[model samples]
Target: MNRRIRSIFWLMTICIIAINAFQGYWLWKTYQINRQQFASTVQSALFQSLEDQQVGDAKRLFIRKQKADSSSRMVIHRFDSMGSRHVRVFVNNRSDSISRIRIESEQPKRIVVTYDTQKRTTGANPLPADSIAKRISSLVLLDWTDRKRVNLAKLKAAYRSELIRRDIDATFQLDTLTSKPQNSLGNFVFYRNGDQLTTDDIIQTSPVPINPIQNLFVQATFAAPELYLLRQMGWLLGGSLLLLILTTGCFLFMLSTIMRQKKLSEVKSDFINNMTHELKTPIATVTAAVEALQNFGALNDPQRTQTYLAISQTNLQRLSDLVEKVLNLAVEEKRELVLHPEPVHLADVTNELITNHRLKATKPVIFDTSISQDAIVVVDRVHFGNALNNLIDNAIKYSRDKVTIQLSFRGNIDNWQLTVSDNGLGVPKAYQSAIFDRFFRVPTGNLHPVKGFGLGLAYVRQVVERHGGTITVQSEPGKGSEFTVHLIRRD
Candidate 1:
């Protein structure tokens, strides 16, 4: 896939995975929290219920067994006091459940009783002695055979007796009394002077609820485990981001490398085509000149013979120059070329180059050397001479009528400048930048094109730069061109 699509795909995948992991962790934490809450609630309820049951049983034992006095004349009075104490203890300890205790003394003449309910103030008045005795007798006779019927009537009588004893004035009041299962403890309360007793069927509220602080602690403990998981997920996310950055960087590097290779391949192709044309032109010229010399009729005339010999020599030198330029370029490309620097007269070098190309010149050439006659530069003799010759030869080849070469020195003693200006067709402005590039030629559209591989100026530039120098061109369309070489003067 393309870079953008691939990046998006990985990003989406990472996001989805991260989201799922986070959600799963959250759900697991929530489940743990809920489970802890349920367990704590159940444990609290069981503990409260067990405590209430033990307290209720202890109160009943205190009333029925511990205070059962056998030899007391005021047995009823003592029993009544004991029952009130039992109720107080039951109320205090059994905070989670309802509890009550009643004690009745039976005598042939009178009946005495004391009762304590979990909740006081039943809103009633005291009952008569006969009615109170009857209620007590019914409770004492309670057994499995008629326990349900007797318990019901006993509770009703208790309510009437309590209302009469308390002397409650209200005409209408609620009576709430509840009976436990046959195997469980129950509580009873009377209202309206033992006229009625109300019983509740179910207890929905817990006697002792769970502590709020403990509940919060349990919740925090459950959440504590998730902290490490969250940290791990954060690390995973960070690693993914780093990986994404590295991958993007690698892709960009590969793309840049491919573009560079493509550009180099194009340059190599241009070099090959230009080299072939350059080599072929010199070979063709030499071959033609040799053929003219071999023809007996052309050699018969002294003038014609000399002309053919000179043409042959010129083409040979051109071929030799082409080979030398190629070899030098090869050495430079491999960074193996070395320069033999020596002091040389610039004027003598220029004159020798002119003499070498004199036969090949198609037009008359004029040399102007007005700046310095004894100008000496430390340079590689062979390469500098070749650079000067290449410029002069180009001027001669392109000029319509005459080629004018103006050589001058400029700058201070530390830095010297050698300038070669030619009055020939100027270089186009657009091609100036690439003119010295290997195998790059300006498109002149001349019907009879000048033979060149475009390597001459490139070679010249390489030589000048190697000598710690700079070369620049000044030209305008339809005007003459000037090439300037600046170098450090040898002390």
Candidate 2:
């Protein structure tokens, strides 16, 4: 797969695995914490119940101490043989009805109880205390020792505690304590002291039933939904980050590719331009030489032959110059061009190039030169002359009737400006920005076309830049173009 597809696949896979793992771990931790908290609450409630029972016992004992009665005694009961009993009695001096008592004992106890001036009895004669104790003992055995009844009571206590803890606001019509199934009317039976109590026996008491495990499950499930939501959100965030990175990478890659292509295009155009220039000048020189030879027999004279020979020699030299320029430009483009700078008078170089051009011109072209005799610059004479000649040739090719070539020196001794202006068709406004680009041509679509491969300005720019100078052009259509060269003057 491509890099983008592979990256996406791996990103999705990793996110899926990471999110799922994180959610699982988070949920498990929540569940464990919730379970521990629930267990803690249940234990607390059990201990609280025991404490409340102890407090109630203490309160009863204190009350009994305030009301002492000789005839009254406290009774204590123990449902299990292993349980203990305690008792205290209170007798009040001011009021007989104020008598109170407390008891703490393991076994059932009976006292001969009197209220104020009245003696209380449950049988024809006053029931013996020992007989009452025996009867209470039997009742306790029936309720507490019976396995089924003990289980039912335990279940009742546990269910009641759960309901209160859950704070269920509604009353349940069904039995709150029992594990038995209920009919539609919500009826059940319970055996207490060998007697059965039906639903009708305690219809007035309100019942609120709750399952503790179910409550825990509901709470966990409520938080459970958030797990999925968080996982999905994580996945979305991860995916978006991955997508952003991928998009940025792709954009950078495309930008790099475009820049490379543009550079290659410039190199290719430069090569084609240099190659055409290299070929055209030599071919033109050889063609001119052969044409002169064709006319040699018709003239049939030593002077004419010498003239033809000189023309051949000059054109041949032009071809040689063209070849050398191409080679130097190639080396420069590759960063291999070496400068051989020497002190040369600017006026002398200008005069030599002007003379060469005058001899080569088919039509009369005016030349103007103005410079201080002391004007000298440190530059590679050959390359500098080539650059100046390219500028002059471009001016002559585009001129209207006569070409005006002007050279002048201005600025301080350390800085010099060489201005070359021509009254020729100026560069168009639209093409001005790209005029120095290699092989860029202005399309006239005329029958008679200018002979050029469009490398002259590019060559001039390169040479000027190598000299630590800047070249700028100013022109308008149908007006003229002026090129200024700014360079450091040699001391």
Candidate 3:
């Protein structure tokens, strides 16, 4: 409500908002990076799949070409020391041999073939190395990009397996361009290596040429790359959100605490003002009566002396009651309230209190008693008696021209229930719970019509709770109010 508190509240609000905004922005950037990494991984898998498919095709093509040539024939010369066969091949029926070949079959699934082309002569009119390299590169590119020639089902299976090995699973559309790609663009392109037989001609009759091989592009469109990226960053996002929640919670708790402290400051000032006025009037009255007797020689007349003495006694008693209320509250707050339990007659105590209040009351008062006869309960006699008295006193002080009070005592199988009802200024529903808090008073404007510190109800609650009991209030603002005390019957 004050200017300084208001400013601090707004500043805290802005700070928390800024912190959350920064966290959100960081999370967004991380998501984008993950998306890029995911795309790269998919591209790598696709490139591997194309290479795998090409290698198998080249081997099949080489075997077919060797079978179609009639002039070149293979004859096993002899068995080598490594269990491989050394074979001589006469190409175009020339005695100056083109190459010597070796074939090794070690495993059922593997066959390695090698050629010795160093002894071949330029006299056989061999094709230039550049022409052979260029032709091989073109064939490889066409085989990779030609959609019909490519075995799509096998390629897809290989691609899926590669993705799984790298921990990626997503739906995608795989297509290839028949023309050579100019750039990578959005797709991944596969290029051949001329030095390695993986893409080059299998024949070693000429020196292999190093050339810039053209690439064939494979176009893959994923259904939801972002969703996959989000899955990857799930833990990071959750942690950020949790931290934001905790930060906001702490800010709210701090704000509420500040508000409560401010309200307590105002309440304490009001209590001091009320206490000063109350003490001042009683002290002034007792002082005046004592001074009159001593200075004016009022002792000469026995009646005058007695009257002045009674006035002094009455004001002094009021002062004693006021001071006791404050001291009781202070003692309870300093430490836990201590109680000495004893068995007492509840009905008798209630009757005695009603009698005392009726005798001392100046206004017209009516008492309605609905008490069970001889109801006994175990409790701290002194503190419990005072708690009852405070309730009765409050009922009387807040009443109209004429007062009507209803006091009841009852016993169940396990507990004793006592209620005090009065035709007084009842508490509002909102303040009913707060009335039992120390130093809290209903806002009655600047001038409080009633006198005394606001320690009565708080003390009553403390005493009741110390005895292992509970208290509750039910009231309407214009009508009357009822206070109930429930205490366990300790035998």
Candidate 4:
């Protein structure tokens, strides 16, 4: 059984470890995937943010040019009754050859013009116009070479907005850089900006061109990307951890229960063997004494007959006591052991038990007693006496040639204590805690020279607890053992 249990324990241990390892591998893969998705999302947002900034700048420039050119331009609009319109304009100013003209009315239209040095212009496809004229928007004179620093404040705002739009709530550091990074694309790259942002410190970095015409790009560096990822997968991580804890707890609980049951089975088997030996001795003795009286005609001699009868009665009594102890334990367990409590004098009981032990014990013994005569404690008299008797019986059975017993009963303000100490073969420290457990003996194996079914201490504990009391043992191997029973004082 022990070997089987050990095998099961090792197997379960390996299973638990494998489960943890697999879970750890799975989580790592998941983290990597989430990281990749995050980087991709950030890159997309950066590109979209650049486009948004460019559109805004271009619209502002166009609006400013239109307002400036509106005063010097010729306005033409032809509308039918159905609000359908065609616009045609000829600019009289011969500033530059017609380059680009954007016309905006109820609907936006672009009419690009081609011209000659004669200060005359014609549309690519004209609408019945005889002569040609030049029309140029104010944008034609502006220099494209003056590339100012990209609007960092505006870019940051747009970048953050785009990230939020994509469901990412992470903080970042943004800067415009003209020099391209020399590092490979997928690996972590360092961007040092006084804060010393290293590759390890950075979560992700996305570089996007500031504008279409410039070589400059905006770089966004995110710190602690893992924190964000953890928050995103909070529920999944939490649930997995909880399940792992519960699984380990259940495994430990099951293992402990198995071990406890195994111990119980061994103890019960020992109890059964001990009970059989105990029963056989008394039965054999009685049978022999009866046989002597019936077959050997011991009845013819009154003295011999009386001796046989006495021997038979004594053995019968031993058998009856053995059966009674077993039955009482069973009845107590089945019915939850109710106690009928009454006031009992502690001193009188102890004195009577001491006298009985002195008269009945076969070995040479010494009794030392300290009992409070005035101490009257509430307890079930019969059960309490039986409990004490079991303790005395055990002390004598377990001792060497000469046994010295100490019986002490004292009453405190809160409780009454009865202590039984003896110079017996004291129990080892390791087995003290288990001594009160049913069918648990200090010595292991099938047969023990000491009598009793290992029910004495168990019955004592049950009786004491049922009376709202407690029992404790203090023992040192070879020195001796002291058993104390504490009963609560009731007014």
Candidate 5:
């Protein structure tokens, strides 16, 4: 039975460990999924923002060289020519960087037109339509040779303005669109998730005016907000953490239970060995006495025959008591021990127990008491006396020197705390907690001085508890031991 219980305990421990491992694996998988999903969602938002009409129109209008229909009214005021004038107009069309072209018009009369983006807004001071046209023409006269920094501030501002116009809430939306599209043909990057266009580039360039300028390799980096997955997969991540906590708790609980069961199994095995040792002496004595009366001439002499008979009877009774104690423990373990609680004076009970033990002891044993006010406690008188007898018996058996016993009743508001202390080869602190557990004993080495099944403390604990009380002990290896029973007082 002990082996089977140990096997079950180990199995339970392994199962708990496996469950924790599986949960950990699942949490890691969920993290990967969340990251993939965020990438997908952010990509989808970017594509949708690019397709926005306002964003598209803003790029188109920036490069619209006088609406296509108005191209028929050519000539920025008929060029005066000393001969037939050869005049050509060009617009600065480099979209990779800001226009830094040193605009120069050549025709024997040269004029340089330059503009700064920071000092003033382009359209704040309205210029003559033709004047604006000539300035733009001079910019393109250099054939878009401006390798200037692209001021993306205005374009990013326009992108957000459009997103707002489209009723796209950035809070709930991942459209962290901070860049303006340059060449309509900039290299594209795709993401694994989101609304659509999974095969799109991470850097998407909107349709800018078709220019003959070489497209410089541009890097468009898209970054999602921090802890985006933690926020987005809110419930999944939280549930994972909760699962881990529960798993850890179960693991610890199972580990503790398995350790306790293993200890209990060892203790119970030791109990059986001790019980066998205890029963062997009495059984051997009874058998020897019986042999002396029968096989020897002892029966022929009435005195000798009576002596053998008495020895056999005494040993047989001792054997009976040992077996009875074991059976009683079994009953207690099965929770089948019924109690008949009634009003009883704890002091009277203690005195009777001490007297019985003193008479039964093989050696002269001294008894002492510090009992206060014979307090009436509610308990089963018979079983309660039996419980105290176990304590006294243990006190006598484990005594290394002069055996001494003490009994006392310390009163609490609603209970009588009965204490049974003894001066004996005391218990070690390590084994103290297990002392009251069924079949547990402090390890006694080869000396094997005391002999009995380890059920006395267990029986005491059970009976005290059945009477709505508790039992505890305090002891040190060399000093002695004390058992305290807190039984409810009816008064």
Candidate 6:
């Protein structure tokens, strides 16, 4: 089309592409950040839960180490040897004394037992040393095992609850595999099922191996973390999606506008070419006719001069009509089509156009008009007659030999229907819809037989619309075509 419009269109295209690309990039970055943040929050809560488990494990180990009864510690007064059946235990409570001592061991682990001198002198004879050692050792090991089970169950439950509170819903199995505790601050590191746990092997207790604490593992995993992040960013993601939709809509609208503008420019260009051809033909004919009258001394014979003069006048009138149609179209495009509505007879108007057509035809073409009644309509006489003439002229011009046209008036007094039918080479089904579009002519491939600048039906449709009427066509291929104009009859 035009250079300036083309430039603006290209600039808009680039802007749409660039903005979309930028938004895409921004969305990608936001996704990554959200994922990273979700991971960070999850890990932080996971490690904190692991630390809590470690503290619980430590507390269990301490409870196992102290075999004192709940009432008081089982302390030794003077016995302080690590030999068989003898051990020193601290008395943590001064006001009370231990009534019983519980010891637990699996196998091959030694157990030493001791008691206060006062309890030995209470008249209850002590059991045989070996039997006492074996029984207390087994009970201690049983108690420790039971407490271990309880503490482990609590730890697992706490771990799950902690994660849930942080919004991480994971399913896990307690890793049955076990290893000696690291005996250091790193004893609480968390591991998934398949992951590794690094440990340093320094001996923990200096005196004896009391509670052989080992690290237990709870391995967990959840579904997609990104999906979780998407849920978390509910309104944010929705707003972003809405923004994308709006952006896409704007892009499509701009593209559609540019394409329509380009199409209009092409149509206008064709109109200019066709207009130049139509105006030149009439002007050339008139010029030739006038030149002949001036140069050939045709005035010497009255009939010859009159014939040349008529030819000149006819061509000049045709030329003037073409120019006037163009000017009227321009004015209508600017929304300046003026109407001088007045009372007029529809039948008279139809008859006048038919009689004009008969007088203008070179070879005899059958033209007829039937007026049902002299119905009156309020319309601009000049433009309304011109609209009717255009429809009739197009019918004749596009027809084959033996051109027969009929004009008829129908309908009641309130509204009148004027139909013009012609036995022309009828319009194709494909081209009928677009016949009234400005500069849209039916394709006459290679022959160019039909003349006129494709403005006749368009002008007729516009003039009728300005007078508050409607026009339509009914036609079929190879059959005759009929144009019907409906206008309100004015009193």
Question: How much lDDT does each candidate structure score?
Answer: 0.55, 0.56, 0.69, 0.72, 0.60, 0.64
TM-score of 6: 0.57
Once fitted onto the true fold, the runs of candidate 3 whose alpha carbons sit more than 4 angstroms away are 54-157, 164-231, 290-302, 342-344, 374-378, 409-416, 487-491
lDDT of 3 by residue, 1-491 (tens): 59999999999999999999999899988887777677777776665665545544543443355466444543323333233323333333444332323323222122233434465443342233333233333444444345333355777788889888999887766644333344768433343232221223211111111111222234456766767677777788789889999999999999999999998888788889888989999899988988988899999989999999899898899999888878866776789878998878877888889899989887888989887766778888888999999999899988888889999888863588899999888999999988998778888888778886778898899899888899999998878799999988555
Highest TM-score scorer: 4
TM-score for all predictions? 0.44, 0.43, 0.70, 0.77, 0.62, 0.57
lDDT of 2 by residue, 1-491 (tens): 24554575567656666755675576557555644554344334433433334324444543354234234433332211112222222222222231222222211232222233343332122223443333333433333234231123444354346547764222222232433324667553333234443444311232212222111000101123234334535655566557656765665576567556665576576556555756676677777766876864725777777776777777788777767866765676788456687877888988888899899887678987778778888888998888899999988888787767777778654688999988788898888877787666665543224666567899888888887889998989887788999987544
Looking at candidate 2, the ten consecutive residues that score lowest on lDDT are: 213-222
lDDT of 1 by residue, 362-455 (tens): 6688877756557777889998888888877777776768778777777654588888888888888998888888767776543326776677
Clashing residue pairs in candidate 4 are none
Error of 4 at 293 (Å): 3.8
Query: Local error of candidate 2 at 90, Å?
Result: 26
Residue 352, candidate 3: alpha-carbon lDDT: 89
lDDT of each residue in 1-78, candidate 6, tens digit only: 478777887887788788878887887898888766655655555445544543334334434554543443333332
Residue 32 error, candidate 1, Å: 29
Clashes in predicted model 3: 0
Give the residue spans of candidate 6 off by over 4 A: 1-29, 47-228, 231-258, 336-352, 358-389, 403-423, 428-433, 443-448, 463-477, 480-491
Q: Give me the runs in candidate 2 sitting further than 4 Å from their true place.
A: 1-324, 340-344, 368-370, 444-448, 488-491
Cα RMSDs of all predictions?
Answer: 21.9, 18.6, 11.2, 8.5, 13.1, 12.4
| Segments of candidate 4 deviating more than 4 angstroms | 69-153, 175-191, 194-197, 211-217, 294-297, 409-413, 444-447, 486-491
lDDT of 5 by residue, 1-491 (tens): 56776687678778877887887788778778755654454444333433332223322332455555243222221122222122222233221212222212122123333343332222232223345435455444333345333334543554456545654323332222222234678644322132323324433333222112322222223434335545756797688778878877876787688778777677777877887888899989988988888888888999998888888889889998988877766675677778888778777888888778777689778888887554677778998898888988898888875888888777754756778898788898888888887777777674457776677788788788777788888997668899888766543
Model 3: worst 10 consecutive residues (lDDT sum): 202-211
Candidate with best lDDT = 4
Model 5 TM-score is: 0.62
Off by over 4 Å in 5: 1-33, 36-226, 234-265, 488-491
Give the clashing residue pairs of candidate 3, or none: none
